[model samples]
Target: MCSSVNAELLVDKQTFTSQNFKTFNGNNIKEVNVGWESYGNLNPQKDNVILITHYFTGNSHAAGKYDVADASLGYWDAIIGPGKAIDTNRFFVISVDSLANLGVGDPHVITTGPASINPDTQKPYGLDFPVVTIRDFVNVQKLVLESLGIQKLYAVVGPSMGSMQAIDWAAAYPSKVERMMSVIGAGQSDPWTTALLEHWATPIKLDRNWNDGDYYAGSAPIDGLTASLMLITQNALSADFFNQLGKQTVPFQALESEPLHDIRKSHSIVNWLRSRAQARATTMDANHLLYLVRACQLFITGHQHDFSKAIASITAKTLFLPATQDQLLMPYHAKQTHQALIDSGKKSQIKMLEGPLGHLEGVTGISQHTDAIRAFLKQ
Candidate 1:
């Protein structure tokens, strides 16, 4: 289990604003804001900066302790500290919250999602918010880097959706990125992955309260959102890992009362999973999740149909880490990306992370590959 730390570290949230930012769909917003956090100090040359993109439902709080008595540190706290994998002692790590991110009421995250109020009508954008792509996310980060006077980045690293952004960074701005570390991510969204994303969104859209993404003032679609999270959580872990979780004992009895009959549920596993899913739904907004799902569905490097041609433009030295047991984002996808990059005459390598945590190995099982990652970054 991950434990809380009482370390005194400053995690500052900063915002960057751009005027009339145009998205991939040719729609323009008057102003766009990106929330970000920085750890460690930048050297005089500013060349030691490393950008860490976040996964789905994650924000800019990538590492360090938010409060002295917080339950747990940042998501990547295990590998990003004074002497950890990325080593804040020698490198300055920066993380940015993507547009339409799952804010979960975090005041520091200033994302424009379905729940955000539209400046034009003073009402929530909901479905009115223009669709965004991975390339758009990379472009916003580029603006942030330039605003900070950072001409070049030592490395661009991320896991899952974050890895997609990292790949986009290398392809979109090859000159600015020196290296890239993509974990449990692909160069493009394949048909299988796209189909999976569709299933995740089906439940949300089917909810009566969804109201075509305009369920802001009314009660959010907690039931549909919880079902979606449950599906994702099951795919995110290996069958064995999920089985272990299922076997754990629950404190509450599983029962349901109906008008005609009382249903007695004895399966502890189903009860546990539902409870966990409900807990996450309480904090997340359904419309924000739908927006992110659409973004992931549309993610493709270089916006090209040809995968090889898409990665041919990437000039950064790249490292691909694919979890061995990931049922959600299969390992073959990462292998295909590595092969495409290699065939394109770009420098790239692949390392399979052997673990039972499935897609979550990219985060929970990260410690197993820290040595290899540390060596790769040093190289």
Candidate 2:
């Protein structure tokens, strides 16, 4: 089992704010505040630092419980701690919440998004927040590192949306990062992936209650938000996994209903998905989710026009770990990026993770590749 130095780590949330921040699109945000958390100690030279970015729905809590009584550990608690794969015992693992983070309502997450109040107008930013990109996430992280006097990174790593940030870090600051890893992710959002992301936001937009992203004063677009989450949950899984779900709950009840009178009825699996999304929606904001979707869709290494030139600038030894069954960010995304890195003569290697959970395997099945990660880090 993965364990922290103190048995179960009791971590605290810390805040980092950047003033007069300029976004990749030439937009200016007066202030950007994001929560961060750290595991292990920063060595004197600060060279032992390893930055781990969080996924789309995740916050900065990457490896510990916020309190002793907490019911669950961080999502990746399985392979990040004292003696685990990333091995916090010898390296300082740090993670920061990205601007437009989906978990904006979680008390543990400090992020500036559409849900945040604009100091100038004393109202929620709504759709007014500047369009932030993965490069902006990298820049915010860089500011945090500079604040702590950390100049060199031992490794920059993450999965899903986090992976995009990891790749951007290596490409943007080639001299500062030593190693990089992208799990269930790619270097850029291709045309296909970008189009697919639009579906996640469509349900929310279709909700009349959304009121064009200005629903903060009244009822939230719960139905739309729930549908969006359901789609995300489904897309993140494979047909192999989907078939196994709701096995005990009959496959179809709507079809068997008396007189076939209702078109609103759904299958057990649909209800199951809605229930899961409802549980998660309680602490989430609809606008924040929309912003995150846009941020993900706009991702590209170095945030430049020349994708080739940007990726070619990376000097960090790279490792790409793609899930064999992922349908969301398919394995080919990682393969394509890895091949480019190898062609450029950069240290790059690819590994496959196996599990039924699909894209989520990158989080739940990370432990299976402990040896591979340990070996890569050592190299």
Best-fitting candidate, measured by TM-score? Answer: 2
**Pairs that collide, model 2:** none
Lowest lDDT sum, 10 consecutive residues, model 2, at: 250-259
Tens-place lDDT digits, model 2, residues 139-252? 999999999999989999999999999999999999999999999998889999999999999999999999999988899998999999999999999887887764555464
Off by over 4 Å in 1: 1-8, 249-266
Residue 48 error, candidate 2, Å: 0.4
TM-score of 2: 0.96
* Candidate 2 Cα RMSD after full superposition onto the native fold (Å): 2.2
lDDT of 1 by residue, 85-171 (tens): 888888888888898887646765777667777899899888888888887888888888888889899999999999999998888
What are the Cα lDDT values of the candidates?
0.83, 0.89
lDDT, candidate 1, equals 0.83
